[model samples]
Target: MTDPMQDPGFLQDPYPTYAAMRSRCPVQPVSTGSGGHISYLVTGYAEARQALGDARLSKDTAAFFAGKESRRRLHPAVAHTMLATDPPQHTRLRKLVTKAFTTGAVAELRPFITQVTDELLDQWPVGEPFDLVARLAVPLPVIVICELLGVPEGDRPDVRRWSAELFAAGKPDVIDTASHSLADYMTGLITAKRLDPGGSLLDRLIAARDGDDHLSEEELVSLAVLLLVAGHETTTNFLGNAALALLQRPAELDHLRKNPDEVPAALDELLRFDSPVSTATFRFTTEAVTLGDTDIPAGVPVLVALGAANRDPERFPSPDLLDVDRDAAAHLSFGHGIHRCVGAPLAKAEAEISLRAVLARFPGIRLATPPDRLDWRRTRLVRGLASLPVLT
Candidate 1:
């Protein structure tokens, strides 16, 4: 009967609740409060991984709601994106987008990422308290993604605003507004790219060809919208959470400062220690599936709690502790299986550059206010601080 999404305390620090659930009801039913919608929450590491990779669990909302009353509730633009599709559709959409984030492409972006990180740090108010979320975490990814996608600098603020509003839980109207507005903007942007290709990824997507198969107009807009939303938001949260994690553990912070070479490894531990994505997107069972001791009926929605799985004792020793030296590469932060995040490489590069720059710039930086006084975002989909006030 417990609803973690409705509990402010759970939203602030869900680890305790996740630990309790993993030990007690590993696959428990809970309500998300979206028009009385309910879902089975998978908390244990094995169960979560199994559920995520299960082919019986459908990602297409339209397939689940084919003739249901909720069929019309979702816009085509929102429901038909690569994230919401499986198999052939997801394959096609992802193929067009994957090359841009391949190792080579992402490597090319390091210089740009470093330049932007340094530029943002240079603008940071020195010797005075400043909100790291606003000054550093928020702008770095936004700038990088915008530049990568060939989006005009002037339009990024609106994209950021709309993306933030879309993820705001309980604001269905705001979500709807942002969804349609961003879709429209992406549609126009794709059109602009078509007319005058900027040689950016967006242009590549527009020109992508595979054996006479090309992205349809709707697919192009949806893919653009997806990249815009996912590319920046995850990295923004990762950077903010990484900074907060390091700041809270002084010895670990000093260890990392002394061993600057370990920043790359530290990023993996930071991601596992406090995942930015609390849960995977919605998945529904196409047939009865037993997860742990719980029976999940066909057509029932399931959410894989990434935060819980990352800290599950069976998967991680001293699950709650942040050990930068741990071989944390196997963590499920970027997720596992087919739907794993495509832009993870870019996110890691951005975080590594940003974290190193921040530490080097402010060797004596520490939280300006007590840790407990900091505000965490209330949204259930993403875990991040609203503001991280720090002083050097």
Candidate 2:
């Protein structure tokens, strides 16, 4: 009955609101300030998974915006990426990049990830306070992604700036400027790769474009930008949020420290408890569909509340408690069905390595400030902390 968005407790901790929604209305209607109305917020575990995998719920924004005034507002490149596609096109694009994210690829990068983590940790000043979010969380992922993509190390700072701007581009003015700037930058990179192909993902994509004719230049640039942004930003939030959660809940941190084997399981629980990406990317209905008791008509814009679904009491016992050993994989943190995240393995590895390394190295790590004093990101899409000052 309560508006989850306007609830203060929901803003701080949404588990209560999630439980209420799951019981009262699995599919409830809500409005967006843009004058569009979303017919339902799918909060239950099974239903959220079903909707994510369903073909009837389209990821293609163009289909939803077709013949609508909003069609003219979206950037063309945004609609072309794999995130906005469904079926054969999504499958095709995913195949072109799947090898880069396979378990073997991530396994090979473990040593490199460890090295990066150690190098950053080695630089941390002793005794005094330091901001973990900026010094470590932000740069580690950016550096790893740059290396993976063969992006020049010297260009990392600029790349990070561009990535942050792109993530913050939810505003109209910011979106327009950031989109144009990123497009121009990517165009130059793609051109260089075409001339001097090398061993990076971008180079592989260029080779694919030239040899197989399966990929286009525009698509290559779009994919490159997507990898750069998604690869770094989401992981940054994951590591940052997980660290903050552990600091807030010392018992869970101790449990992880004692049972090093539970790192993977703990990571899953952390994701479920406080997801990095609070909402699904975006979905538009292909045709009028019935979800629970709600009838969502075609062309309606819908965003799945992944954070809410993860804490649904009906799905997991004691969903609000942080249980490191719980079978938390059922949580929709990586989503489900066809639209499941392709970079999940890599992200999981990164989180496990990062958390383990931090706990091992800084056993005395604790929040330098009170939990409530810590700043959180204002956006609903990416749940992150502004800064996490910790004492090693």
Candidate 3:
């Protein structure tokens, strides 16, 4: 069968395809669009959980891309970031920045998040249709991340633009250009922090590099770039997806509106219903491993379908239905194992705060157009909408 992934309808709503794939077998091989490389896609809940934390599965990209053409297309800084490396290298890099991104550290930003939410809400046009994605979802995170990194306010729009371009999967050249541009911008920012440090996270990272030699210049640049890009990009999509899910299910939206305390639970259910990240980043096997009943050879690439795993019938009953009261905290939307997202707490806080504020301010909000007509982003990695027009 032709890969359903190549179809536009599938990209817009892949749950049906994932359901069929999961029913056939938990693990199956599929060809990656790039280089015709075969990668095992693990869709079952149990298999995905095991594969995520499996030490034999390597995050090293070099092992998967040995050809000159493959090597030429990727930037070393991007290929060397914490996400692309295994411990103890990944351990060291993660530790250097983990302190600043801890749950406690991120929780400290609640006031700031609320403030940003309030300010953005105040700008919405009264009784008119507007794009929530462009106005709220995108800027909220971009502003928060930039402020955390000590990036000046004026430069945030560029950061958001570059981040979006990096996710333009249909255009490899555009992705490459965005990657190089973002890397260069971070390189310059790191250099500036080194000369005159502030109290921000970037300053602390510079201290680690200059003080203990814990981080090299290349690693510094790469880490900053990763934080900046992933920091905003993930939460942006999360907010958009969460809002879209709620608006489509007015009953669930009303339930949350009535029981405001259940906002956190709603976030979890929404996350499982429509994960912002469809699949965890690439994982290559270091040695031959058996996942479920399938034997995957060493050096082969593996992709854990987080979105699919969350919907696995064995894990959650009536997986297609959104039950706000259901305990969906175990969902792998933020991923699992040592590579789990460090900024998850912040993302959750942002979503909860933003959603509550939007609901409170716009009680009559509804989809301006039919749900099926909404344009979803045509990307495999990040599943989200191109725009979310709503009547406020």
Provide the TM-score for each candidate, comma-separated: 0.97, 0.94, 0.97
The weakest ten consecutive residues by lDDT in model 2 span: 70-79
lDDT: which candidate is best? Answer: 3
**True-vs-predicted CA distance for residue 84, candidate 2, Å:** 0.4
Cand. 2 Cα-lDDT: 0.80
lDDT of 1 by residue, 133-175 (tens): 9999999999999999999999999999998987887777788
Cα RMSD of predicted structure 1: 1.6
lDDT of 2 by residue, 120-231 (tens): 9999888999999998889888888889888888878877786676656236666556666666677788887778878998888888887875797778888888888888
Q: Name the lDDT value of residue 218 in candidate 1.
A: 80
**Which scores higher on lDDT, 2 or 3?**
3
Residue pairs whose backbone atoms clash in candidate 1 = none
Among residues 3 or more apart in sequence or in different chains, the pairs in candidate 2 whose N, CA or C atoms overlap within 3 Å are none
Clashes per prediction?
A: 0, 0, 0
Please give the range of 10 consecutive residues that has the lowest summed lDDT in model 1: 67-76
